[model samples]
Target: MPFSFPTGAARFVAATACALALTSLVGCSNGEGGGGDSTTESATSPSKSGGTQVTINDFKFQPASLTVSPGAKVTVVNNDTTTHTLTASKGGSFDTGDIDPGKSATFTAPSKPGDFPYTCTIHPLMKGTLTVE
Candidate 1:
């Protein structure tokens, strides 16, 4: 015979424990555990309409490095609690103005193909790289 909980409360507790264990396992497999590479890369492929997107969450870019076609539209999503801006660190190649919290902004990739480093204008410490191919 299989083991079983005697009461409804006990069953609920058992189910919750199982759910928590599964959640941990899922988080571990994905990069959500913060144990693997700290950066993400979307190289040269983006949806036709949505385009390439860099998610800003927890004060960092989800995909720290991205590669897109020249003049392609790059969307900057601000999922963080505070506002942020994806601005080019060096030359004024690309800037997404200011993206409020829960908001998003878009910028056009430079025509010239090369590596373009960027950072959050409000939070300079947050940095990322954009490659135009």
Candidate 2:
């Protein structure tokens, strides 16, 4: 038997396809850092037990971008010569305040997944982002 085409069904199918595409792009994995050495902010899923390392160097984030499961905990290690911070953007996932050089900060990833762009309070130009899966 052939499937009958309904007027609304086509729209629903199109919408579903679009949603899948968006989701795939949003959470596409590229290791701990999604930006891949772009000096941007990033998010990453902790090892089931939680806590992933993010290296801060040259006044910039090593991975620059990342994707992690919601509610995962992450740790940002300051490996540079300056202080840095990870301030959550709008989703209220996690934030690190004033991490000194050679130090590390930790935060819990938000339960809800979303795009979070953050910057260091001490330095506005220093920015990074996180894509919660």
Candidate 3:
């Protein structure tokens, strides 16, 4: 005898598999889908003299890495559903305290040129790097 599922079990399994495959495809499509890329940024323009914007979504910084002019103002926007912080790692420089959902904060870049690491104090796993030049 052959093994078989209940009346609707086979259909359900098929539908589930299809859904999972589609979800996987979407997640791998672009930087907007899933949180895979470690150095992704959503900034469409360069870090000008005014400021650069970084978006936080999906519990991760949209642009995980950025390069800006020295003393430039970096704006961090939290688009996620939870609060997050853009705190400098190892007490390097600036920290944006408790950025609520849909809110934003600004921090001035270091006057020197170097790589500065930052993370979310609330979610330590969320990390980012800022390069001042």
Candidate 4:
């Protein structure tokens, strides 16, 4: 092969670019921690008319159950050390992506007038539910 070598400066630039790309990819996880393999369905804003806040900390969900009016807004606050996602189960009315520690995720759902179970996609043991009337 012809004489070809990366100078120290060139190598540094290439390494920096690679590091940046990897960091970006690592931050794109759906709702899971590490890599870009997010397993949560992602949260969506509901067309409802109410508001509630759920805090995630101490490896548990605060106020595991909530009762709100039809068409309400729910805000999920993540205060844990790891990433956590707020996802609705069957007939789910909301889904929130990875909420980093000390961060929050908000989701608005249309008035459904019923009960909806939710949980953290990253930690299945952390679960909760919402009841709308």
Q: How many clashing residue pairs appear in each of the predictions shown? A: 0, 8, 2, 11
Clashes of 3: 2
What is residue 98's positional error in candidate 2, in angstroms? 1.2
In model 3, which regions exceed 4 Å deviation? Answer: 1-49
Stretches off by above 4 angstroms in model 1 are 1-48
Q: Against the true structure, whose lDDT is highest?
A: 1
> Over all chains combined, what TM-score does candidate 4 have?
0.60
Q: State the TM-score for model 1.
A: 0.66
Candidates ranked, most accurate by TM-score first = 1, 3, 2, 4
* Tens digit per residue, CA lDDT, model 2, 4-122: 65568787998888886774454322233534554334446353344666677766665677787787677888886557787876655578888988898888777777877766767
- lDDT by residue (55-128, candidate 4, tens digit) is 77666666677776777678888876678888887755688988998998888754768878887877786766
Candidate 1: residue pairs that collide? none
lDDT of 1 by residue, 19-121 (tens): 8676445431213353665546555445446698888877778688888888989888888666788999999999999899899888899999999999888
Evaluated at residue 100, the lDDT of candidate 4 is 91
Give RMSD to native, each candidate. 8.3, 17.5, 8.3, 10.4
Give the whole-model CA lDDT for all candidates, comma-separated: 0.78, 0.68, 0.76, 0.70
